[model samples]
Target: MPHSHYAPRQHASARADAPRQHQPARPDAPRQHTSARADAPRQHQPARPDAPRMSSTTSSIPFVSASMDLSQDPSSPYYVHPSDNPASALVSPVLNGENYNHWSIGMKRSLISKQKLALIDGSILMPPKTDPTYKAWERANNMVISWITRSVSPSIAQSIVWMDKTYEIWEELEERLSQGNLYRIAELHQCIFNFRQGELDISNYFTQLKILWDELDNFRPLPKCTCEAMPDTKKYFMEDRVIAFLRGLNDTYAGIRSQIMILEPLPSLRKVFSLVIQQERQTFGNETDMKVMAINGPWRGRGSSVNRGR
Candidate 1:
């Protein structure tokens, strides 16, 4: 109870209960934040593609863009490819006067592939000069004309000198050439009869015959019979062709022909052709072997004589 600065010291419990004074925060200490991230610099973010935009008018409508691809549209026949030009040779063999059948067929195929067959077949009629596609049709038609003119001999080209349209040229050619189907049939028959494999090989002979047969077929189209007899009719025709093919072969194939004919069911023309070809190969090989033996026989004889003397 002595006067110690005239003041008594408070207990430790009262000091602990007293409020503390304010202090500056340390750099590394966790501080109370006013906002979680309100003061931080904002980052630029790209809009999501699927997110709806906040527009009063457009918010209710979907954002869309569309484009049409028409480069490969098949229904558009007026489109001429960039590669199709005046100087392009479509067919291998150009049209000559006598080969109209072959030339016309080739031209038809080439035009059909190019989608320009309608121009020549009278399907795509000409349009008036005032029409929007008139110039387009004219350009395509002129291109076709150039191809046709260049695909024929000079003398033959003269025939189409006055023609202007594709159909005109095509019709003119067909008229001038297709009139002699009967005469052509007779000529083909004569040629087939005269054609023989005397000096020619089997393949060449068959190829020549096929050419004649195909040409004749164009003139004389096969019947499109769906009847029950159609099968028998085709078989009869096949047998006739086999006979014709065998008849053209050299006399060497006579035995093979006999063997083929003796069968109850005659083989197909191609089968008979293959069989004859095999026989031909065998005959050729045997001849080659015999020639080799003949050449070696004399040498062998000489060698034996020389050895005996020695």
Candidate 2:
């Protein structure tokens, strides 16, 4: 019964010659070889012209790769996305000579998102000339330099083209173009002082003022005040801003401004904004009513003069 016609070929004498007729693709089979090549199957082998032989006893183990590149890994510090290029400006606005502050802020934000800020910020120091990593470091440095060059205007790029390191170019730009935030702070103050609701509506005027105030805040953050009197320093500054907002409003809001001032603790900037918007709506409604009444007639005003005026 052992060699009966009904028996499967695997259970027959053919099992003895299975190594030649059918070589199973087992992962552990390499360990059994007395002499293994230096370039074994475990190493990276290019796609061969012949199809791989697979059998029922094939191993599921994956082959080991020879390459150790981390550029594909998102979490790796050395990782660079395939899409990122030097010609692509990560920021929307290009850096001209005058807009250093805005441009620098935009660039810092873009660099931080890419995880390549370390390359320029001195976190990744240059390795030795003899070191293998020095080449990689140099490549990344060039990439950052290219990005900066493309982002700035041609004149600025020409000045920084000869610079070796990323940090030097960045520092040089800051040194050359940045007139210190003090000048910007003063300019902001003057603009804010002069800004008023002349032709602009309440919402538009407030938006303009808010933008200036926000930019100024970025340039000059309030100092840390641990003293007893200055414990709530930001609160006082906020109140001052509220006053500034009111001072810039059109004269039509004099009544509204006076009412807001009489409050002991003073209303917040947000509260004042809402109140002024409401007053603007009411004033607009009154003006509209006056226009409609003037067009209709003086029927209610002088009894029968409505028909005479027509």
Candidate 3:
């Protein structure tokens, strides 16, 4: 008789080479119920009501960063509050504590370009509440404040942060920095006195010299005398400037200096500057010619030797 199928095989060794078999799942087992959380779609957080909204049209502008743009885009890193800050893209000169005069001049040019000079120059006073221009005045005031805050260093900005009016900030900066202190004037004077052309080309030398002159002038400007002695004073001042310029030149200018010194009444500083510049050009030309001749000299001798050998 055949053995029952459910019974363990008597010849287990004979079935060892066959694949192993496992029982299937029973119908009595409980089924799994999948949670909605595992399959639900993701949701985005709503934007804040107070946040700036970027206009779709803004995408058309080239090279505009969201932060630097004045458009309503709070997501931009450089976005400034419209009511509290000026547009960050405004042209401004970086103002360090030093060189206030030049800085102020450059800032003025920038303000003029923007037509906002009246804001800082005290030409436009505060408008009355009933005036139509009051809104404009307020807008200009905010813009000027923004410009000042962005232009100055943090330490300097702290000094003028409390200033409300454009003129007030301007005046405070001028009073604090523009007044030529005696010590500063002396330092600039010494700088001018010791300045020399050295190895610098005439243009660079003159540029450095002019910087000293400008700084010195800021400290102790030429007197604006209109009296009977003004003519003599002007002449003396002119001669002094001429002497200062001539003294700083290279030794190569010695002959030119002598020619200028003997000019009876001495020409104007402008005329003297022109003459010196022309002399510099001529000197440079001569130097270039000499260099060319020296370089050619060696080649010419080599060529002659080669021809003679041939």
User: Each model's C-alpha lDDT?
Assistant: 0.74, 0.75, 0.68
lDDT by residue (179-221, candidate 1, tens digit) is: 8778889999899878786555566678889888888888877
Q: Which candidate number has the best TM-score?
A: 1
Give the TM-score of each candidate: 0.66, 0.65, 0.59
* Tens-place lDDT digits, model 2, residues 213-251: 988988887887788767468789999899999998878
Off by over 4 Å in 2: 1-70, 225-227, 285-310
Better of 1 and 2 by TM-score: 1
Candidates by TM-score, descending order = 1, 2, 3
Clash number for each model: 0, 0, 1
TM-score for predicted model 3 compared with the true structure: 0.59
Show pairs that collide, candidate 3: 67-78
Please give the range of 10 consecutive residues that has the lowest summed lDDT in model 2.
301-310
Tens digit of per-residue lDDT, candidate 3, span 1-310 = 3566535565564475342331123222322223334334222223432233444445535435422333234432123345544645343456677768778877888777666677788887787978655655676677778887788777888888887888889988989887666777788778888888775555567778888777777666778878999899889977887888888888888889999999889899889888987887676755434443444567543333221110
Q: If both were scored by TM-score, which would come out higher, candidate 1 or candidate 3?
A: 1
